[model samples]
Target: MTALRIDGPWFKDERGRTLMLRGVNLGGSSKVPFSPDGATHNGDRFFNHRDVSFVGRPFPLEEADEHFTRLRAWGFNFLRLLVTWEAIEHAGPGMYDEAYLEYIRAIVEKAAEHGITLFIDPHQDVWSRFSGGDGAPGWTFEVVGFDITKFKETGAAIVHQTHGDPFPRMIWPTNSGKLAAATMFSLFFGGNDFAPETKVEGVPVQDYLQHHYIEAMVQVAKKLSGLTNVIGYDTMNEPLPGYIGIEDLNAPGGIVKLGSSPSPFQSMLLGSGIAQNVGTWKLGITGERKVDTQLVNSSGVNAWLPDRECVWRCNGVWDLDANGQPTILRPHHFTKVRGRRIDFSDDYYRPFANRYAKAIRSVSPDAIIFIENEPRHVSMKWGAQDAPNIVFAPHWYDGFVLFMKSFRSTLAVDFRTGKVIFGSKRIRRSFADQVASFKQTSKESFGGVPTLIGEFGIPFDLKGRRAYRTGDYRDQIRAMDRSMRAIEDNLLSYTLWNYTADNTNARGDQWNDEDLSIFSRDQQTDPTDIHSGGRALAAVVRPYPRAVAGEPLRMAFDIKKKTFFFEFHHDPAIEAPTEIFVPNYQYPEGYTVEVSDGSYETDLVTQTFM
Candidate 1:
């Protein structure tokens, strides 16, 4: 395998043949530690952060061969392998885990044996495990004067471990807008600007957090520097904006209003023991709607330390009146600095991304930098000079299926326009057009760089976990097929959301009840069968052009008819034969190949048709 590089909106191999990447996220459990039961539902070890190990994340080194072989056989040559900030420096600041680095190097060596190429992903959701998701360390909260144990009582965050059984489905995302996550993200990205008075160990909180994060990843890079299979690193996963540019903290009707919608001011007061009535919304067949209002965090527990005020309060954004009531001192504090409208991307995210790229390249000059925008916001103003060697890696999901957890073949919702589309023909077209928009953004905003759909997949436990008992995965198959078809329709490169080595029907992805993994041991009734452990294999395993002789014009796959079609204009300058992956799982009895005007051969062992 040759090292991949960007060449004007396409990936080119060492021999310079245009390449398209198709892969899966190595594992979902990479977000949590492998030892001490770090699963989010296990609340016993929430605060014991220093005494943990990530030795077996993604999978132990001993079990790497099995998982890597399975992924390669499924026609995945590239992988978005997950790593974490906590995994590297869980002990504390500046303490690198030498043993974990050795284990990771061994795993990368194993991946190379299967001809697998991967880029490291510093995965996170919301913030950290202690605050409803996973990514940063627990000490991050403490250093900022937060008490992790009281996050729930103060309505600062919602965690599955503390909330207990029958967890509220899809509620973890709301934490991004809450006090704990919102404040952390604001301080992490804009502390020097938004909260000038806040600091951790006498250093600005943003610099402290971002510096530690980039350095931790640099340690991994230094260990895997000479490995050709380890190509690049993602800056971060799903970066959030965290109340950076809100006009009014008391205003409602913001971008995200899933459940318990609270304004910035409301969130600040709620965390300070001021009970307030917040509006709650619910998702239904007709989209989201406000159902009722409830007074939450009624226990009046403050999330901050005793006598230590909120970061925003300490900055004089708000204050406690003489009667001990919170009052808004500076309503326009975050909205503007000196009469200029603040854009989180242009002002904050872009600078941080550039800084990360420079730091990583300083260690390994040839490493590629993968960048992503905020999940809910529009594309930022990017340019060629922003980062030298960069790949535009943004995530997209079928809003209807992802949020509703049900498949509707004839109905689809366009989240951008908020219009309900009808008919299967229109639905497929809508999906393709929506995905194509990402490529357009790359060209228009980022100088026509290579685009990869970082994360996209369906929940395996859709329709209330009906497939687990019945063993009928037709709904799951249809949902996955639709998403894959959209990707194929655009000739786009992508890495599916995940393949969890330890996923089960009971626990889902070890974090936040997400069951998106394509493989699970619980379904592996027959160990000898390579495809038995897979969920919805019919849609997941399909033919794709691994390497093209020229620019690929079109590619499509039909799941119901079991037919594959690819069309590409041959480039006369290239002599290499275009190779396509023909998985045996998709064509059990063998199949015939037809090419437009070329000689081709088939390798049965590798299941590739040239």
Candidate 2:
């Protein structure tokens, strides 16, 4: 067997090249619970068992080792290790819990023991601690003029609506008031703005926020750099589009506006004051949401349709003001704000990418950078030249047919042909074509840059029985297979959306049910692993290849009987051979086989028992 180096990228060997990206997301939000005594599994408030820990405490090191070993035994080569900005800076700014960093290091080292690669993702849902899930600490929101902790008491629609069970994580994007305010403040404080009022502790707030975030990330990167398999970092989970407004195109002249308003569509900063319609932003405002009928503009009034009604009924953000007139106030930041064709041709996003890349590399140059493009701009035609790295990453979703408005699935209307594909019976064609485009674009974009389907899973445990039929877990897997096969069939790599322990019964509501985790919160000392959702997904993933000294290796599996052909690559070497570990399975007549490499033959049963 040949020893192959696989720190990152696919490992090449003579027999079968092993794709190096069989990965899963270890949900990071459950590190510490808002309620310590609250029902939690592994110290996190969502699950009932203590199998996993999120709140700055170390999950039993032995358990961590076991988890890694299990992942390897199950044929996973990578783990998307998630750590939140909040976890590092929970106490306050300029303070990172040194102990937690050590724990992370231990986890990485343990993972290495199991031959797994680790990619540190600064995970967050809807921005930061103030919004939900984890990222920047709660204090960071104060720079945006809002106390995240106060949202619980203020009865703000965005905050209050999410307080119930099954925390509506990303759903806040459907409304954009509070999120808008927060983003505006972040940009105002972080950007080049030097206004006196925007100062935090006498320093510009934008600078302060960006500084703290980068500092925290640098600390983690430095601590984990020594680990061989630790790859790059996911800079910040889904950065917001900053507070900019877009117009209701259906209005006369297809015109849009640029200002904050409660609406779900993601807004993008076209260039400073100029903006464009992208997707809906989540509204986060304090007190009862005001709705004034007189404010409605008949010329551009968007009637309450069934699909649009939910934005209003669920207390979601809408562009309409309190009186129902469009307002400039836009919601949350960085939800699918992708780099545009124009931006690329003109070279606009490079500065942002360069700055972020530099910050990460300063601490860990050996790490492989994983970059993502906004899905809106990352459609079938887009290519990886737009974003560079060993990992040309992108996300996939089944669109409105699955997640609906709660998710930012856009209605497909071929902008090139002006043909609406959203409500057509040929929807599958649109979906399939988009997926195929990803493969073709990856090759064309970066000359076959290593691509990874960074995200492609869905929320399960919803009340409706029809959800699965409509693409819940099972359907999500099927759709994911469509994308996964696209990657696998194309020899691409990937990591599933998540492996949180919060999925069953929607225990960790903090992640909005996006916790496509495998573990169930069964508190039994040794619970039956009936709901280990990810294990069920194992069938879809291809196994890792074993190679030696730069020669390819071949291994065959009997899917029907769960067995492996543990033969080495063809080599005319010395006589004796050693036995290798193969998948255990039942052979009714007791196993017996002959090993041959065309020129030689070996009989195992006739060999010595000792």
Candidate 3:
């Protein structure tokens, strides 16, 4: 595989052919520890974080060939490979997991052998496994005065490990506004400005955390930068702003209002052992609304360790008053830095992104930096001051389908206006328009750089696992086709959310009740066939222009019609023939091609049209 470089909105290969960086996230289960059976449902040895490992996450090296073969057969030449900060530096600060690093190198090398190109995705959610999601190491909480064991009791986080089975669907996102994750994200991104007094080993926690995280990724670069298949590195995955831009601490600031919806002040107060009746919410068809009030931390469980006080309290964001009662000191601590309000992406995320890019490129100078901010937020605009070869790699998902775990092609709700869309055509148009808005943002905000939908997909276990039970994937196929149509309409490059080799319908992606993996072990009836357990193969495995000779004008595939249409202008300068992957699955009985001009040839064995 030849190395790729960004040329305006298209990825150009070494042969000057425009390339599409399209594929799937290596796996979803890579988020948790491979050992300790750390699939969120099992709380066994939950806090024994330092001793865990993630070497076999997507799969052990022994099974790499099988999974890679499947992905290759699906026409995935590019991958957004998932790696976590906790996976690398879980032992302690400056302690790199050499074995795990070697394992990743082996995986990358193996992927290169399979002709797959990938960028390292430093994946995280909310914060870490102990904080209701996975990413940062457990010691990150310990060093900053958090007791991981008490997160659940104090209502600081909704941990699936301790919260046990029947964990509410998509409730893990609520952790972004809770005590544990919010505090960690706040300190990680804004500790220097927000918590100047709080330091780790005489250095500000923000600096310490950032330094360690970038260096941890550098360890990966040290191991795999030499591999040609390793294309670049993502700055961070779906970064959250915590309380960075909240004007009022009394109201819920997150989009997700499920479970115990605690306000910023309430979360701070709860971490300090204050009892509060937090609003519990359930998402109705219209929107998320408060349903009832639940008394949280009635037993007075402090989230901070015995030797420490709340970072917010110590920083004077809140403190005790004359009557020995806690009171808010500065209500707008996060929102207003000095006098005026601050933009999270502009102020905090950009600086961190620059720093990370510089650090990564110091080792691998040619590494392209993939930039992404918190989902839904417009990140800082790039300029002469920022790093070069940067790609705007933000994430998106069909919110309705993802959260609700149900799909109806005929019914759709507009996210911006909250208006209901009717009919299949209108619904499809709505999805395309939404994605077009995202692409237009990249053009207007990022100075016309290349863009990739770093993550987007539907949950396979929709409507109480109907497809899994009946083995009829019509809904799954339709849902997937709908998303792919939007991507194709925009001609945008993307890596679908996942391809978890060890995924099972029961455990989901093995964490947080998310069952988005295209393949699952539970559905694998035939071990001899590589594509046995694939869900919605009709839509997922489809035809596409692999390497265009020149600028691509339009691309579309009608799944129902079993037809693909692509239009592009050929660049006469490049003599290399154009390549399109017309999958055998789409036309297993054989097919014909009609070109506007020039000659063409088809290779059935390689599944290519040249």
Error of 2 at 209 (Å): 2.0
List the global CA lDDT of all models.
0.86, 0.45, 0.89
For residues 203-275, what per-residue lDDT tens digits would candidate 3 score against the true structure? 9999999999999999999999679888899999989999899888999866578989999999988888899
Cα lDDT tens digits for candidate 2, 1-610: 2222233334432333333456777653443443343222222332221222244322446567555554554445677777877667766778777877887888778777777776887765445534433455656655534433333323112332236654443444432233323343335322332122445677765567777877888888888877767767775554443322223312211001111232323221111111223322232211123232122121322222222221211222334567864443423222213332223211322334455667878887755666554334442233444334545576665543233322222343332233545443354456556555665555665455556667665444333434433434454334444444444334445677655443344343334334344443432124333223343343343333332222223444433454545433434442333323221212324454555533333323321110
Instruction: List candidate 2 stretches off by more than 4 Å.
Output: 1-18, 28-60, 149-157, 160-162, 165-170, 175-190, 193-197, 244-349, 379-390, 400-432, 440-448, 462-483, 506-510, 521-535, 538-610
- Per-candidate total of colliding backbone pairs: 1, 64, 1
Residue pairs of candidate 1 with colliding backbone atoms: 128-133
Worst 10 residues of 3 by lDDT: 411-420
Off by over 4 Å in 3: 415-419
Instruction: Report the candidate with higher lDDT, 2 versus 3.
Output: 3
| Residue pairs of candidate 3 with colliding backbone atoms | 128-133
Better of 1 and 3 by lDDT: 3
